[model samples]
Target: MPSYLSPGVYPRETDFSFYVKQISTSSAAMVGVAEKGPINKPTLVTSWEQFLKTFGGYINEGYLAYAARAFFDNGGSVLYVCRVAHYADPTDRNTLSGQKAAAKLVSQMDMYLLNGDPDPLPPQEVYDVFAINEGIWANRLEVQIENVGLSGGTFLLSVIYKGETVERFTDVSSDENATDFVELRVNGVSDYITIHDIWEPVGDTGMGTPRGGTYALSGGENGVVDMADSDYIGDPSQHTGLFAFDEVDALNLLMVPGVTTVPVINAGIGYAESRKDLLFIADAPPMLEPLDVVNFRKGQGTYTHAAFNSSYAALYYPWLEISDPVTAQKKNIPPSGAVAGCCARSDQKTHVWWAPAGIDRGRIFNALTVAYKTSRGERDVLYPEGINTIAVFPDTGINIWGQKTLQSQPSAVDRVNVRRLMMYIEEAISESSRFVVFEPNNPQTWRALGRLINPFLQDIKEKGGLYDYAFQCDEETNTPVVIDRNEMMARVFVKPTKTAEFIELNFILSGTGAVFSELIP
Candidate 1:
């Protein structure tokens, strides 16, 4: 056949139709084959122990393998795996399910809280006023209308309903500022009461605005923020701060990535035999250090667990798992829980937080308040609106804010010494609204201010950089910001620069001095 292929057009060769018969069909083609494991097992079984877990949790159910195989057999072309955690705890439910069991227990708890009514505990019936009356389709947000006060005189209102300052107004009707007054805004946000309910002066016994033992804190201006790094009271910083150390021991409980150390604060009151945490908890323990044993006692079943989120105030506001100003500022007693124990106050800026002034001076709030300066004259006001927030300068020399008792009057009155210190901040080169920052060429001062502002303004503002940082800018610069001791003095002497009320803007350029906030580890 090879020689016959030369004559296809004119000369005839062997017929092509006979060629298929000569060549075997089976031997005609060659194909590559993929290898597989020795043959027959169908389903892959996985042991419970084979499941992956992390951080006291299970991640893989192993059903993924079967799904993957099925998908491979079907039309699923390709897929990728996403790591995850099993949110549902599959402990034990037996014939039922673990989730069902947990759900049953939780439902029973809800039922118990429901007391007898369809609503959960019938809102506890503690003189409820106004909350969204939502957050609960079938439950209610128990509210208390307390600390209503007069501003100028007619009938201003201090409307506190369900953990919020709904509104505040200046009652210019009467010349005197009434201590207790509540004006209900009929149509606004917390429209709990009416104009008629605004000024109902019941009596002193019934109307005396609750004060934390009438102890208003005040402190002279110190140009530095307050900082507290208390680990174990018997540890190091407590000795430097001259705070009392007894009762609760220090702990390494609180920890962050780079920061490791926490103050173990003891709540004074506890059950006769039982309590939470290794250290005992109580409303107030005797011979306490940082603050007076005064507590705005709380009653049973009153406060929610959302208030304890703040590490500093967790001991006093044990019921709060949330760090809201409204809940943190409230006064407390025995079961009614309030951390009236400690504070950081300057004549200008006073911050009230929860760490009680107990024997464990190593406590965060305790360390902060003790080192904080107390005013000889008036308080230093930082922001125009009442300050409901607090921050510590990590490795900074000072701690700010403390056991502050707010007045029923809109303008907070310090029952204890309170001040906010700002330090070694770069001074204003000129008198304009803005200025350049001094380079931290001096390593000592660099570390001083550098340590002072961290964990707070780390990403936002570097230690020594361009002073012109817009609130939301992401650029880094090398401008200097000087500590205007004069500005601090001005805050003490002149009225707050910005406010809805009157305007009083004066400058104290001379005689202003710089202060340092020291935090000894």
Candidate 2:
């Protein structure tokens, strides 16, 4: 409110137009073992090349690199990758220790400062560089240093990887205030390594001697240990493993890629459900028969982890045969990565409410075949058990054949499309209604909420996400008792559109002499 003490006329302009900001629903997050990268840090890479640049190339048996490549190849636009490692694995953590070189100073002026006779603080030698990640890849790295034009305090540095110079710093000085101080210039900018420390010897021992030389980094080795659930579901307080994703703001899909153990998969499901904004795509263990999948879905399998039956998680069976990046030979890998990409593509081409299945939108990329040849009878058994199937079609190549959540209680959420549609609507409405938190509890505020939500629902209906919807926030819903308690009420009725997976056509036989109009009626 504004007050005017002495004024004939007051002019005011008020703007009341506000709209909901739609959340991004296509990003994905994953945690897995990698050959080299920051340990347990969530790094966002938008393209396959960027992932490789950060995490290195594919390993002989590692699937995270291959999965990341497949994700980008299948139309996923953004991914947050977390790398897990074992403590005993060979690493390059403290490989950069340099010895101090003598400094040029008059002996008389280099006495101890205790009696104010002189200041005696020797300069410490800083290691030129060390690998940014732990792996044999660092052994390919080389650091070269040289004096620049015989200058007093200036030097040049060059970093080489795989026989090619990747980074260079010219005229860098040991002085802290120099325009191109060696430590400041190379620590944060260079991807291969960071400058560890710098030092000089005491009392003119090695003062004028050039410490220019080329050195190769060593002590990087890939560990030989399998990842466990503890590695994937890292400590929440430390934000490692799946907990690393908490640092991220938005991602609507999650995949653990290679680890298909029941415990890890179950952990992923619970984590996804807790987040409430994304769904987990679980991959079945490789070579599992169709009967095994059915048994697994029915909660009668011999696996140690409990079966999860919820809309937040969906399971996919059979591995995908795709060409390996290193060998270019077909290799069977889990389908979780490809499934997530298809979901992203569907969300972009259609609405998130639409299922990412069938031939049109579910076609997978860079896939040669599936690990199993599923029959129609097998699909019939699996679909009812809430397992999404990947099958090969005559001309469509490899396609995601089924779309259903693990929700098997016979509710509308049993269908993936309906469940995701509800998620979308809930997120959008919840975000838009946040402004009503402290607004007046009068009819005006209620009407404003209705105005904000009805149009959004109408848009979804028009886009085929909803068959019909009604937004009710009138006096009847928010009675006097509700108003007195500082609360508002709204009832939203929505009939979500269902995907047509099966259709039956019946033809009736009529007598030859029957009239055409009568037969039609």
lDDT per prediction? Answer: 0.21, 0.77
In angstroms, the error of model 1 at 399 is 27
Candidate 2: tens digits of C-alpha lDDT, residues 242-277: 888997878788889978777787888888888787
Instruction: Please give the TM-score that candidate 1 achieves against the real structure.
Output: 0.15
Candidate 1 local accuracy as lDDT? 0.21
Per-residue CA lDDT of candidate 1, range 236-346, in tens?
A: 222211111122222101101111112223211111012111111222222222122112222113322221121121122111111222344322112111121112111
TM-scores, all candidates, are 0.15, 0.87
Candidate 2's C-alpha runs over 4 A off are: 4-7, 87-125, 148-151, 198-210, 222-226, 474-487, 507-517
What clash count goes with each model? 100, 11
> Model 1, stretches more than 4 Å misplaced?
1-231, 234-521
